[model samples]
Target chain A: MKLLELQAACAAYGQSQVLWSIDMEVEQGAAVALIGRNGVGKTTLLNAIAGVQKLTGGHLKFGGEDLTATPAHGRARAGIGFVPQGRHVFPHLTVMENLTVGLAALAGRKAVKESGIASHIFDLFPKLTQIKNRKAGLLSGGEQQQLAIGRALAGQPRLLLLDEPTEGIQPNVVQQIEAALRRIRTELGVTILIVEQYLDFAWSFAEAYHVMQRGRIIRSGSTAMESASEISHLVNI
Target chain B: MHESAFLIGQVFNGISVASLFVMAALGLALSFGLMRVINMAHGEMLMLGGYLAYLTLLVVPGPLGILVAMPVAFLGAAFLGGILELTVIHRLSTRPLDTLLATWGVSLILQQAARNLFGAIGVQVVAPTWLDHTISFSTGILSGLTLPDTRLFILLVAALILGGVALLINKTRLGLYVRAVNQDRPTAAALGVNARLVDLTVFALGTGVAGLAGVILALLGPVTPTVGQSYIVPAFLVVILGGLGSLVGTTIASLMVGLFTALIEIYVDVSVAQVLLLVFVILFIQIRPQGVIAVRSRALEG
Candidate 1:
């Protein structure tokens, strides 16, 4: 079943239009990657999906429920967890406090207790447990990225949207994140839609890929059919 | 010995005044920190609290009347603040200058309303008999230093409130949401934090604190409509000097302003001390523009 769908999605930053009538769909429990060069409205599309960027014109649906008019927080409560680019972690808050913020998404919704969600997150990222009390700002790039993803997962989102999760991190931690994403999808059965500039990581993690350029999906296919080098070459990487 | 004792007394006065400033400035600081909108009418929350305390005491008269008035004033002011947030501040949140002007207008209207309701002359809240005595010092360098129980009570109440606020911000789930929202609104919202609800809660909470300040103010003097006006400026200074709406920053800034005002008044008149206080703030800002505690964030530098 399709867990997410976007029809004629259009978004703009002020008067400069970034996303133009983009249509996309992701099946439940599928890991999909959205790849594009800089300035190709990839991040904007993710923002639109996360409900942070308002769709100037479009219809968005999650789990067959219309979500076009839903605000960001509403989208979050409706099971859309967004790990935005740059890992916008709450700097002043401690690691545990940051994770606790994810529980806030489940205010009126049925969910596991705080400890239940937290221990799951810690199991996913053991590094977080050791430095749970440390302020998020003091964390390195990789740690912050992990925290951002863990923070989103703490909400127990059915659909997770990650934008460049592997950006500016150590290779070892990047592998760790990739491994976590695989488990998050295969074991946890969470649907994943990731926007990435890293072709290698995108190819390995996502079962399907959509290439976006100038706010529209230009090409999409199963990862089994097309190689990362081909898509990388086509997009002139 | 007398001189030293007088200095000690002024220090106590500074602490008392600091406590008042903390209550007045906290709400402004929190809301401003979160929304980046200055509430020009925040002073009215204090006024409302004072008036509410006056009215509550009328019905529940006794030594515990002031205690009863505290929560009444807090809730009343908080309700008014919530209304102000919904009606005016929320509408003008994006346009900060417009919010200022609108809230300024609201402040004027509230002042007028108070004037019409209770008269411009102001009403008094007599401190209970329990607060009537003073702790006196007689021999030593601190001799002649006299501390009133009312002032001590104010100090204790302020401390408790401050502790409560601190705990709320640091330890609670709500505080976690508040911190997240303060740092990144869009991101926090994306994480399913109802930013608007947080704003309403904080705005109301801040105003409630202001109301509590008002009740305390009434103990020191008359509960006039414009009473908040006198402290509003200093409260703004405290917020400015405190950084990015951080609680620690606000508390420290309040102490600095309160102590500076009190100590300066020793050598100069109240008016001159006020000028010196402004000058001190200017100089202080020049050195550390970020305020007492700097909050580092990846977004929203302003």
Candidate 2:
């Protein structure tokens, strides 16, 4: 089943027209990679799906419900979790506090045991447990990324949107994140749509790939059939 | 009175005044820290609270009338503040200067409306019998000093409000949302926090606190239309001295302003003391541009 679908979606940043009419779809529980070069509207597309960027002319359907008019917060409550490009975490808040903030989406819904979420997140990112009490601003880049992803997962969204999650991280932490992403998809049954620059990382996780160029999807194919070098050449060109 | 007694009396007066400053400045700091906009009409919320308390006392005339008036004022001012935010502040949210000017216009319109409804002279809210007593020293060096029960009541009420607000910001779920949005609006909204709701809540809550301060201010003076104006300037100074809307910073700044005013009044005239307070604030900001508690944020403007 199609968990997410965008039809002729168009977005603009104050008349600059960043995303032209674009169509896309993601199946339930599928890991899809949106790969493109810099300034290719990948982040903008992610933002439009996350409801942060206002769609100029388009319809977004999530789980078969038309979400074009839904605001960003409404989209979040409706099982769309967004981890932005910069990993914008509340710096002054402790790691625990930041995680608790994600639980805000659960308001007006069935009560879920917070301890369950906490233990699951801690199990995935064990390093978070050791520095749970420390302020988020004091954390390293990789640690902040972990906290950002963990914070989003606390809401237990069915669909997760990540923008450049592996950007500016050590290789060891990148591997840890990749492993966690694998579990988040397999164990929790989350559907992921990640915007990635690193071809190897994206190719390793995503089953299908969409290459965006000049505000349009120029190519789409199964990841297993395509070579990373060929795709990298297309993006770099 | 002895020299020590005189000093002690002045210090007590300073603390009493400081409590009022704390009440007035808290809302200003919190909302300013979050929205980066000042509600010039915030002073009018205090006036509205004082007016609401007066109206409440008319209906519930008894020893507990003042107590009943407290909640009435809070709700009344909070409701009005919420309306103002939706109608005025929200529309001009992106333009800080426009918001300030527009709210100032609102303050004027409200002042005119009050003068038309209640009269230009203003009304008085009588203190209950329970607050009529005074603590006096009949013997020793403090023989001439007297502590009025009304001021003590104000102090107690201020302390309760401070404690309540601190708990709300630090412990509650709403508070967590508030902190999250205050730190990062776009991110919080993306995370399912209704940033608009948080803004409205804080704006209303700030006005509500001002209303509480209004009730206590009525105890100190007549509930006049311009009563809020007298304190609003000092409250702005407190917000400027307090760092990035921090409660602790605002409280400390209030104490500093209150004590400085009271202590310097012993040496200079009231008008001169006001000038000195402004100078002190200017100097303080020159030394610490980020206010008392520096907030580390990723937002370039913040």
Candidate 3:
């Protein structure tokens, strides 16, 4: 079952067009990677699909439902979770408060009560429990990333978009994050779309890969050994 | 009376004045601090609230009229504020200067409309019997300490409004949405929060609270069409000096400004005191531009 499909999509930030008639697809329960060097439209494409950026042309569908015109909030309500780059956590709010912010989407006022969803997040990142009362800003980089992902999952999303989750994270925590994401994909059956710059990370985790360059996916293939080297060679290291 | 007694009396006077400023500044902070709009028409909303109180008197025409006026003025001003937010402010949310100029124009237009409707002459607002006396102390070292009944009323109203606002923002379910909007608008919306609706509600709540302030002000003296003009600057100062997006900061700043102005006016001319206070605020801003409390959020940092 196709979960997301983008056909000939075009997008721009003011005068600079960042995505040019890009075509992409993600099947249900599939772990897909969008890999590219810096300055490519990898993040921009994800933003368009997330409904944060409006596409200039073409169509986007999620769960066989048209989502080209849906606004970001509506898309969120429809169960597309996004953990944007830079771990944009609410710094002033407490850890518990930050988790509750994700529950805001389920229902206004009524869903605001403390619920069991938080315990699941605690299970995923148990460190959040000890410092639940502390402000989220004071958390370490890895903990903040976990909180960001945990916060997104609190919305009970059917699909997740993670952009550079391991950008500045330490190696041990990076392994832990990958393990958590794998659990989210296989155990929870949530569709995963990750944007990454590291060849080893993307190739190992994602079942298939899309290689982007200068606002276009120049080549794509299964995560085979020959294709992985070929994709890596296509870019200047 | 001893010098200490005189000082205590002036301190009390300053606190009462600060109470009034807090009532006015709460709305100013809500509009400027949260929405990021320099709503120059805020004074006009205050004036409109005064007019609503006057209209309430005409309809009820007794002690009962004062009772009817408070909620009517608050709701009326809130409704008007919501309309203005929808029609003008929302369109210019990103353009602070343009929003400021447009609201200034609105202030002028509203003042003109009020003058045309109620005439240029000031309209008298009658205070009830409960508000007609002063609580005075004339014994021991505290001889000649006098607190006006009206000032006491202002204090009560301020306490009630501040308490109500604190509860609404801190404890209620709507407060969650408000805080989310304040903290990270993009993330909030992406998490399925209706950010626009939250903006409209916060704007209306601030304007409505300002209307409550006007009701308290109306009983003090003549309710003129330009009554709001006198307080808007002080209210802005309170918000700025207190800091952006901190209610506690606004409260502390209000008391500071009120005390500073009152104490200075005792030793110097009122106009001289004003100039000195401005200089002090300028120096303070130069030292710490974020005011008493700097906000820590993704929006502020980025």
Best by DockQ: 1
Model 3 bad stretches (over 4 Å): A108-116, A224-227, B297-302
What TM-score would every model get versus the actual structure?
0.96, 0.97, 0.94
lDDT of candidate 3 over B200-285, digit per residue (tens): 99889888888888887888867788999999999999999988767888999999999999899889999999999999899999
The candidate 1 chain A region of ten consecutive residues with least summed lDDT is A110-119
Against the true structure, what is model 1's DockQ? 0.62
lDDT of 1 at B129: 95
* Candidate 2 B-chain TM-score: 0.96
DockQ for all models: 0.62, 0.59, 0.52
**lDDT (10s digit) by residue, model 2, range B127-242:** 99999999988788887788899889988999999999999999998999999998888888888899999999999999999999999998888988888999999999988898
Docking class of 3: medium
Candidate 1: tens digits of C-alpha lDDT, residues B124-179: 99999999999998988888899999899989999999999999998888888898
All candidates: interface RMSD: 3.3, 3.1, 2.7
Give the per-residue lDDT digits (tens) of candidate 3, residues A42-109. 88888888787889999999888898998888787777888888888788777777777787556533
CAPRI classification of candidate 1? medium
Per-chain TM-score, chain A, candidate 3: 0.92
